[model samples]
Target: MQSAGNGSEDEAQHYREGQEPPNPIAGITGDVPGTAVQAGAIYGGVHFHSHANDEGAVCQLPLAPAGFTDREGELGRLAQVHAEVGDTRQVRLVVLTGPGGVGKTALATRFLREAMAEFPDGQLYADLAGFAPEEAVEPDETLDAFLRALGVAPGEIPRGLAARSALFRQRTKGRRIAVLLDNALSAAQVRALLPGEGAHLVVVTSRLRLTGLVAHRPRFLDIGPLDAAAAVRLLNGLVAGHRATIGAGTFRDLARLGGNLPLALCAIAGRLVMRPDRSAERMVAELDDERRRLAVLSRHEERPVRAVFDVSYLSLPEEAARLYRLLGLHPGPDFDVRAAAALAGIDYLDAEEHLEYLVAASLLGERGDGRFAFHDLLRIHARERARDDEPAREREAALERLFDYYLRTAVAADLTLNPGRWHLNPMFEDARESPAVFEGRTSALDWLATELPTLRALVLLARDSGRNQAAWQLCEALWMLFSLRKHYGAWTATHQAGLAAAEDLDDPAAQARMLVALAGAHMNLGEVDTATELYRRAHELWVRAGHRLGQAAALENLGVADIVNQDPRSAIARFTAALRIFEEQGEARGVAIMDRRLGEAHRDAGEYDAAIGYLTRAVDYLTTTGDDYMASRALVGLAACYLQAGPLEVADTTLGQALRVSQRAGARMEVARVHQMLGELAQLRGHPRSSREHLQRALSSYTELGAPEAETVRQHLADLESDTGEEHPGEELS
Candidate 1:
């Protein structure tokens, strides 16, 4: 380790030498700089083609990309490939990938123009029309053109794919050349075009990853949105000789708001350059109003990013467009085709076709791994269009369908996870049918958690739609995931909305449920007094409605608030009261939960042995109830007692078990407590460095869950840093 660290420092010192000349290939010392025939070399040995044969149909490059806009990075990669094209022995295939209108073609053309000198024999360029108005160019057509370029008679090219590939490879085996396979359909199309055992470089630009070309080991380049600097540079380049009047900050704002997409930026710049009178600030303001920008900017027939999207949208079958809009409602950053289908209320195969159509129009992007995402700004754009174009009634209908989908699915998950638990009221409406039962609870929760944001939106939408029961039922169905995952922000907002709706509808049961959720959020935020008030009101409402279960939950929550307020005596009394009501109602899960709270209050009130006794019972009750997540919480509380009661080794062992249990059940909040206790133990043992690591991990978990304890732990970490004169590496534990 010492030697490795020293070597790393030595390398850093060497790099800091300002006088040293640049060396691109210095790492591979003792070899000739340019002697090796690199991967893309096209050796010249034979060309058996008829010079006079130019029949059959041939396609040229697609209109030179209409002054191809952005793609400096693609251009740079092509430049690198061109630099070593003369010496490369294997085929160097460069894949240019992105959402449409990101200028893949423009970059390819620019590369061909600049790198033409490297390939003396010729540059073979073809437009395969992956997203064309007509049928995609056939492989035979591409091969025939290539064979003709190799001086072979068009008739000599065979019709079979294998035969044509062989002839094409043989013809170009010995020649130094470059092939630009533009808008390819798949890896198969381009793989068939590769010259066998030769030096020719092939650049295959496609919208998809085309994973079939494993042998080529292609250098995959995902063309992400440009950074602010690159976007500005491209804008300046587009409006050549016309200086930008906007300040640097304003220009950057426009670029960011445009999502740094080359096509969008170029269009904005072109407008600015042409108008000359409109200030950049005015355009920025228009872009900031995301709801109307697409409609307003899409007035022009040409240069329509929005129009390109509309064309794709309008062409979609009614079902497909409906699915596309629902997809816009996805809460996660990206999702697969299956989720898209689920959102659209369709089959997987049908969804795949729609995804392909969207990709064709550059409305969505496919990652190398085949997952899809809309550009951040573009996604906001899609959502706006979706909301605007679809009628409000139709939109609400779709949202209801989605909301019920998640609610029903979550109920099924709850049953699968704990088959004996009391069932919440399923929506049971014809419009609220679940798509299908999942394979297991884990799979179900994964989907629900992934779709939580979208689900939350649906809950709010349902409440606004006056579907009061649907709104509250959705919240109850997802309570386990929401509380465990610590999605407090969404949880708090949804319940608040639900509470208002229930009050408007005069549903006491719904109101009680919403109040419990509201109190939990306040408790999680450290608003103890506010939480206590909400919990008390919820308890009263539940009693008025004669809801024993809701009353039990409210009492338990009040106990937690009292514990936070440092009134252990009050906490214990409240917890015991809740426990008796839960037991009387035969609520095993509720009794187990209250036992943990009661144990914690006892521990705080200096009853260590009694605390352990109650906690031990709590663990046993949770096991009996089969509530593994809550069971882990009891274990964590027990571990904390052991730590405070002076059995250091026992506490360490128990905390380890708690951590494992929490991790196995994906209880992030419980896991955070384990870290915090372990950290406190480490500090007691005088291992400040290790203590910091544990504390930092604890802080991250708490922060992620929006736990009330996060700030307390953060301050503790700060104190440690100040005392030890060592800055906290916050993410070191992870």
Candidate 2:
């Protein structure tokens, strides 16, 4: 007998580490019950896959997945297989093979439910777990389970594989029974669990073909993707009347998009039908984004899409399998041999070979343009494997190489569009071979546009994966796209992610730099307070680090925030302080940028002379530095001062120069600003026709830029129409 021990730290530590003292009453089995005594073997690996029947004498087959479909014909065929045994002593065997999540187990379970009438003795079931993420079950372990189910005593069950197989056959001989072995990895596993001679039926399901099962001449069903009609029927059944309002064509589209797979359809259905308020259209709309399709399909934690695909993924060859996961680290949905090579850090031929192996395993799908993709479920599964199976350091290294690939490629592509900007390059310690190179500017732009979605996603990926440097650097490299193309949403999203990564790194310098970038994104988006807070944070970090240059930049960002808030006095103070730092550092470019900002502040405050003087000097400074983009911006400030100071000819000439320079430099937002200034200059001159034209042009450009400045342009256009006796373009002004 053992006495209770007080729960001290020492005793708790042992329990926490799972080394607690053994229970003293584990073997005390003298309690009496009001039922017949039944003793059964419960040896290693011997247990039920499901609950026993009400009588507790037999294990009941588990019900199939809800709304089972497309198996009516197969069930009838399976019944015939059992009938044709016709007095033969050999046990009837059937094998079902299909791709993962194509409902192989579901089909088997449904068949068993229907065939329970034929097996008078009992029905036994086991999930062989061949495709489990950890490892497949061994044949001997399965035999141990069968022995206990047959009422063999724990001590009497044989230890050797052959002896266990012999014992399993002997126990089931001449008995009418049903055995379902699901997710079998090989023929050996199936053969070991079969009875020697009996009116017994054994059914096996696996992803692999398991051709060795052919030696037994068992009945075979090769399941494939459900037909369109059957898939729709299955979806309709699962959605219950929630989809009744949706058209048959739309339902077909949903099923087709699900790749005519039962699991995919069911997963989406599970989400919609369960939520009474969520519409089928809304779910369809959510699945519209291919990048998010898998996430949408896996609506719940318990029924994750990755869980089904992990089994298939874990069953793959090591190289092919690892490549399958590494392929998920790819930035885009599909990839060619070169992209695969880049991802796996292998050569093209080797990548192709590995990819082909994945295709053979049904882990990858080949597409047009010599590219391949995972089923959306498989992609999610593969990524999950990359996170769970691969070590953190391993995934980090692979993603680093991928980042390097994306960075270098983006730089190379940028060079095609703006050759003068080629000098702007990311520093890789040892650059990998190019995944691809650009042929021309159009191709480069197309590739950039094509990769935009993933590039934005990778920014967050780098942040979440603890690669802080890569996160900020990738966003920095995307400055050209944000500045020129003005995908405001992507700009802010990536920068926000970069800021998070930088903060997590706890490096003041990196955090300050990210703060500046993110603040600029917020400024562009017209989020004045948010931008101000971000800049203030940067300023504090820079001050703490004593980085005068970074502090100056942060100060200037804050000045921009003040201007947005209509506080020109505060803006001037910030700009003056920033300009003093720039002057101390002898940074002419910084001085020019801050001086231009000061000029805008003065102009906003109605101080025309000060604005003109500051604007002219800044433009001269920027022009000498060959920064035409900044020069254009300064010239616009000068133009604005000229327009306000009763100098029509000079304002018109300065505006033309600003327009020409900004357009040439591809400074889209600046060009829009110049157009708005030109429109105002025209409006001052009473050229209503020209003013309307210029204002409309400015609005169009602002709209295309996705800049919040579009609202300002819209208001200006409204004023132009109201003053010129012209009705608003589309609607009555509020």
CA RMSD of all predictions: 14.2, 17.8
- lDDT score for residue 562 of model 2: 87
Candidate 1 residues 312-425, lDDT tens each?
Answer: 455445665666677776656777776676666678898899887776545678777667888865676667656877777766665655565566666766555445444336
Q: What is candidate 2's lDDT per residue for 1-734, written digit by digit as tens?
A: 22111123342223112242222222223332221111222123222222223453356578867788777787888888888666648788898877787888888898888778778767888887777425666556677777676666665654444445656776677878889998876676677678767788888887766666677889878776788899999988887766456678778878877778787888877776778586667767777776677677766846556566765776677888888888777767776786678777888898899887776556777766677877655776687678777888887778777887777776665554444231212442122234436766457666666677778877888888777777877776676666667787888898888878877877787678777777777788887888899899999999987888888988888888888899999999999999999899887778888889999999999999999889999998777766776788899889878888868889888988898888766677888888788778766666666777777888998898777878888997787667735433443111
Off by over 4 Å in 2: 1-234, 237-263, 266-323, 331-339, 347-375, 384-396, 407-450, 621-624, 722-734
Task: Give the Cα error of residue 135 in candidate 2, in Å.
Answer: 24
Q: Judge candidate 2 against the unseen true structure and give its global Cα lDDT, from 0 to 1.
A: 0.73
lDDT of each: 0.70, 0.73
Top-TM-score structure, candidate number: 1
Query: Alpha carbon lDDT of residue 340, candidate 1?
Result: 76
Model 1 alpha-carbon miss at residue 395, Å: 5.8
